[model samples]
Target chain A: MTRSFVLAGALTLALAATAACGGGEEPAAADGRGPITLTDTQSHEEASRKIIDAWNAAHPDEKVTLDIQPKDADSQRQRLINNAQTKSDAMDVIMLDAVWTAEFAANRWVDELPADMVKADELLAPTLETAKYRGKLYAMPWLTGTGLLYYRKDLVEKPPTTWAEMKETCEEVLPKQEGMSCYAGLLDKYEGLTVSFAEAVQSAGGTVVDDSGTPTLETDAAKAGLNFLVDGLKAGLIPEEGITFKEDEVKNALQSGKVLFARSWASLYGTANASDSPVAGKVDVAPIPGLNGPGSGVLGGANLAISAFSKNKATARDFLAFFTSREQTKTWATINSTPVAHTVLYDDPDLVAKYPYLPSLKEGIIKAKARPVAVKYGDVTAAIQNAVYPALTGETTPDQALSGLQQQLAGLLKQ
Target chain B: MRRGARWFAALMISPTLLVLALVVIYPLLSAARESMYVRGEGLDADGFVIEGERFVGLANYAGLVGERFVNAFANTTVFTLATVALETVLGVAMALVMHGVLRGRGLVRASILIPWAVPTAISGLMWRWVFQADGVANAIIGEKILWTTEGVQAKLAVIIADTWKTAPFVGLLVLAGLQIIPTMVYEAAKVDGASAWQTFWRITLPLVKPALVVAVLFRILDALAMFDLPFVMIGRGKFSVETLSALVWDEATQLRYGPAAAYGIVLVAYIAAIVFVFVRLLGADLLADARSRKGQA
Candidate 1:
């Protein structure tokens, strides 16, 4: 049915090719009385469709059509940036990765949200802060994510509280669980590696790059943090193949009962507990273990922003407001197990009943640190991944990797 | 009539020429221009751009002397050499088997082309799964090795995947060349009491040299621009498999347009120089043959 609708639309366009401009004016009024196109990363297409459906039902005159972008955050940002740079108004509303907010807002690619549109007091502060460039808000915080330690609840009576304990625990338990590894995470050389490394470094009480854009991976704490990975692989606590594992691979490994402990996003909990999962009802989530205790997690979320060149700014803003409202956010949390920016939803009796992880997720979001905010964050991420991945995979020593990271990040930050 | 034919031919080709100019030449020239100017923002906390613009001619190129660029360059060169060499040998061997008098020759030929038909991105994903710890690669090797973790293993995995998907393309090209080789040449060699090895090396090899040389040159270009396979098989930013194309893409996606353009210019220069050497070394005759064939066509 969707295919036929698309086909019919295409045929209409083909037949009206010469008369396109004649009919295009009525729907593109300046007062923003027409349909608004909202672009979202395809990861949560169903939830987005449901939200759009609800919004359309509420406002028949101002329909919101969903435009799904690539699942990869970088590609989604680049596509939006390209469109914005070219001054094309193809997308009125765009979903932005938290880290990309600074870049997009600084370039004036996205419009600053009206001050009244945001209730800072109602949202998780750190996640809300990601939508701001300098002091003004440019985006509306929507979905928020944080790293969680997933462990076999049946195998371990208590989740380890520190890296050392986790390692010792893994070593002790490997013999009991056949054909299974101790732990896995997003160790692949990409942004996920950066997130994983950030959690590790912060767990050891170190930082990769501070808010001032200074390279901070030169301390003992940082070295120890990085060594958690190197030593784990070397000690055979973490599988050697885990170095190549991304989010899905780690999830699959944990879900299939192949790994005892794994680190992944909060979004994976529902999937892990699904009936089809081999370890369903046998796995549990906790704060990612640090060198000493619960470590910091890298803040991951999507924010909604109106394109600067949007033809229907009013409708776009309205749609964004409705999409991230407290009611809609609660619905999202209940339906998709996604953590929304609204703090009220965390304490909502209904949402808490549906998602037991909400309280923990709130705690994670409160403490989660945003990745280094820079116009060149993409380059910074690449540099960190390039320098640190080798060591994580045991191809380079921790010292060498740290020094390389320091030098590369230093150079990148200088530019 | 001749003048009219020339005019019609010129008119026929002009649209294609215009399209090539718009899509290819225009971007190349604009990118070259962009390489000279840095964006407004330096690495500052506020991170604002377009407030001020500066011209820093060749500064971006000079900054490319870092370990990352060098590593990417080396990886690309090694990937090109390794994949091209393996593909050539394997391709020729397959072409030989397919050229032989076998009852299932057509089936064998069709089967060899299947891998080539798979999109590179899809093939890369398939190979990534195959290289996973408990994947088919480990099963076949009788040992578990993380194919995309260590430098050597990851690089080798990419090479193996590239060779698998592309060798058949080379084989088909060589097969086309083989088909054109008259049976009389082999018959004459057989009648003269030539051994199998002698016939293969003396008669068959030289005859297939032109096609193989062209194949290698094309493969060299293709392998150097390899982005999808390595980008997918082993995730990006790994020094072992990051190609120049990947570096350019990484830079471009970051909106470092000037540096990306610089990288693009550098890649074009590198590929052009390599192509020059390749054609001078082995493809001069192949080029001449192509020219004569074009004239005939």
Candidate 2:
């Protein structure tokens, strides 16, 4: 009897194993003419729906279904990767964060797009650069943005173009105002910190990684950039709470009339100028301050990529082209107040008249640099956050932070 | 006849055993197999990164000796011990209060269970706002403290949030234990001139040992796998609050599935070892109860 029971157990185990490994049928391929799903985050759900509606109207035969993913970038990326890894044809087109292009392309989860899919010359240089993995184009640039210096125009005579001027203005003007802090940016220990750190390094005339994708954080320019933030925090020019500020917090700080300067995205312009905002009509935008002059900001935006496992790759590619087209991009920018990849729209007379910050935002985006393009970008960004967070919180000096970061990046990128 | 009965019993339980094997054993075995292989790294001849797995038996396990893994291990252990211990004491007190309250008993019980009812992620967000630098927590203390930033403060914030959310769960379980105790035992102790504290120690405690053991066991298991509380309360990758689950999640999300599965196996082994020790030591009564039930059957 016991032998029979053991035999039965073994039989069940074998059956279960077979059941587990049995689901590997290849997805059937399809031509470009069919219904396809677009998996994107809900941040721009309204605008995305409008764009999809426009596409569906223009081409009734090739219908597109909008599948809204999570609003959080990390969750959205995980969902896309999970779907691709499972070889699911659920998502034909995906909206990828600019930083995820390298990871998706390296893993062959995203199909490489043709170079002529979009007008490469008309798109901003930094935005176009984010779409490429190695030398091949993997995604098409969508909405793009950069960090802009938001300052209270009513309080300061003019926006500061240098870190020294910003500090001097903070020291002079801060004491006179009640409950006011100096400057705030995305300094929390997350992806935003990495972006801000890269911006700082680049603004001080140093790059996080060189052309060969090697760590170059040991330079004096990197040190000066790190010191810009470290010294600001130490001297109370950047408020103590700024160490914990993210994008929303920094934007709130400026809009509530609590901060003299805030380094945030261009979308904050619309909100800061809203009639309900306390600082409405009092705030103005400028290029982010640097050691000497206007500093470069880290490029921030999303891209459209066709999933490698998708059955309807043709339809996906066509939809990407349609969505990132100049006309749709302008509509997206106006409706969502998103910074567009089309460079000419930044200087469009009508757009500039409607949004005054577009000119300064264009300058920031023009000088912006993409974060390091690495196959293991997840590890790279985590290392940056780990290495830089301590310095911002007064646990380490700027010199130590940069050197430590150099070592961390070197180990991470050694491959 | 006896053999026939045994066969019938086996046949009756076969479906349950089959389901268990498919769901539990299968995934565990799959994760074990995955842990032995590492994904190919770097680019291939075509400039695309090499795809597919390469067999590197035990290398992923050995690679867990890094500082990040050690820190996560330490954080996980500390959070489990701290949160479980605090929750036990507070939960017991709440259960006692709930048992004794004659007036507004429903109100008291419901209020106590409210925190437990709210979803953990929601509570994490609510506590985040409260723990903000200029938030109500600082307003109450009248001193600016960066609770969300790195260091011990962030760890404390996580522990506090976890304890607040789960203590009521323990209370609910223990209250069930309290309700089952017969009033006759307390009366007998009273008749023997026992003090209130002495009665509680001798009668109430021993009678509730089985229920308490089960509750603590469940708590220990749950706390060891704590993820959402810390992940939501304190942001991810913060050195202060990273746990084993978070480490696994981080690795998996970064497409390092091999290392992630290895971490998962290590975490499972760690939990199993702790549970075994706990059952052998403090959970003797739990086993005794099971044995008695089987003997009766």
Candidate 3:
């Protein structure tokens, strides 16, 4: 009986293996062309799906499908890297964070765009710069984001132009408004912290790392920026919980009417203005406060790239161009509050009429700088985050933080 | 006849042995081998020499001694010890409660097991929401504690979530152990005029020791390698709650394959040493019942 049981088990296993093989490649399309799968983060999945649907309807011969990725950017990047390393054809079109361009290009995971396909003059210069690696375009800028200072319009008459003024204003206004904290910022020990630090340094008229990937944090401007955050947290102008806030947390604090001011991306504007928001009509946005003047924001956005291993590269590239075209991009920008990289959208009267803050937001996007692009960007950003986060948390002084950051970045680059 | 039986036994076990080698032994050996070689960023160049993989000896292992990895290892050890100890104690109490004569015993058993049946990730996210600054934790305490941001608070939050999700498993094991003890043994102790406390100490504790130890061992190993619960509860890059497994994951994501493998190798060795000490020195005989029962039969 036991021998028969073993024989039956072996036979079942063989049958199961053959059954699994039955699902292997079948003709999925009426035309010979296969479905083009575009993988992007879940944040913009709805907008991406709408565009994909439009594209599919226009060209039924080559259908495009949307694959929403993890909500966290880090996880999405890791998944893309894993797929590329394994030479998997699971992803055809990929949405890459602006900082991933150099690493993806260096790894030869993305196909280089045709020269004619890269219309540099039509897109924002800074946004377009992120899609290029070593003078060749490997990705297309889909959407653009820049940090903006959101304030309770009912409380503050006009937004503060400088960091010191903002602090004084918050101190003056917070105690008067019951149940209100002074400020909310994203100071978590992650990529958000890196973005915040870079914006701060740029707003202080200093560059954390120059275009050639040199650590420039030794400058006084960088020190000033770090000091602004450190001193704010120490003085309680920024709440202690600010050190733990990510974009969502900061938005929650603002929408819940807990903070007088918040520093966040352009995406939060729509959420805050939604009818259900506690302070929906009470909020207004302006350029982020700077040390000497209006703060320069950090350029935050994703770029679309075709996978080198994709069997449908032509369809992927066509989808990329169609998605970023002037008409489609305008439609996307209106539906989703995402700022587009196409310069024409910023000038469109209809867009400006719907979103009154579009002009100032456009200026902020223009002034913002991209994170340091390098082959070892992951290590570089980690080093920056480790150093700057402590300073913001009041564990170390700004001078010490910048020096430590400088040393760690140099070591990482050398490695 | 003995030689032929030995040959037949070996042939009978061959398939399982092959599967064990493929799934378990092969990966372990490959990780150990890969730990010695370093690969740089940004190339899929194949072969050991061609892909910039250089034989670096113990350098990769040495890299595992970084402050971050050390802190993660220390945190993992503390979490394992604390969670396992607490779970064992709680499990014993729970087993006693369930073993006693009580009304609605089925309902209590089913209700207690619901926490364990909930997926770890789902439970973790639920706990994360509860522990938020504006959430129930602060509401109950009325002190506005930053449960996820502070180091101690974050560790305690993870521990609470882990304990809530896993204590029921230990309780189940101990309950099974309790059920197996014959009623006549307790009756004899009662007839001998032994007090309830005396009977529990002399009869129940010693009899349940084997199952409790085995449960503790499994829990210790599991808690040490925990990743998903903490990852979901308190996001990443926090030195306070990052476990050794999470550290390995972080390193792997950064494309540091050799260092990640080294971490895996070290973690395996550490778990092995722990299990060895538990079974060999602590006298936790996991297979004692099977051997003794077979002998009796």
TM-score of chain A of 3: 0.89
DockQ of each: 0.23, 0.66, 0.24
- Where does model 1 exceed 4 Å of error? A1-31, A164-175, A179-181, A209-220, A393-415, B1-13, B43-47, B51-53, B287-297
Taking all chains together, the TM-score of candidate 1 against the true structure is 0.89
Note the Cα lDDT for every prediction shown: 0.83, 0.88, 0.83
Candidate 2, residue B107: the lDDT equals 100
- Model 3 steric clash total: 0
Error of 1 at B129 (Å): 1.5
- In model 1, the clashing pairs are none
lDDT of 3 by residue, A1-415 (tens): 3464465445545544454355435322221246789898776777778888899998998898788898777878989998887777788889988898878887778878986886788888889888887778889887787899999999999899898888788878887887788888888777888988998889999998886667899999998888888887887777777887888889999988788999998778888988989888899999898998999999888889988778777677778889888888887877777788898788799988888678878889889998887777878888888788778766788889899989888766543
Candidate 2 chain A has its poorest 10 consecutive residues by lDDT at A24-33
Model 3 per-residue lDDT at B47: 10
Tens digit of per-residue lDDT, candidate 1, span A104-125: 8878788888788898899989
TM-score of the second chain in each model?
0.90, 0.95, 0.91
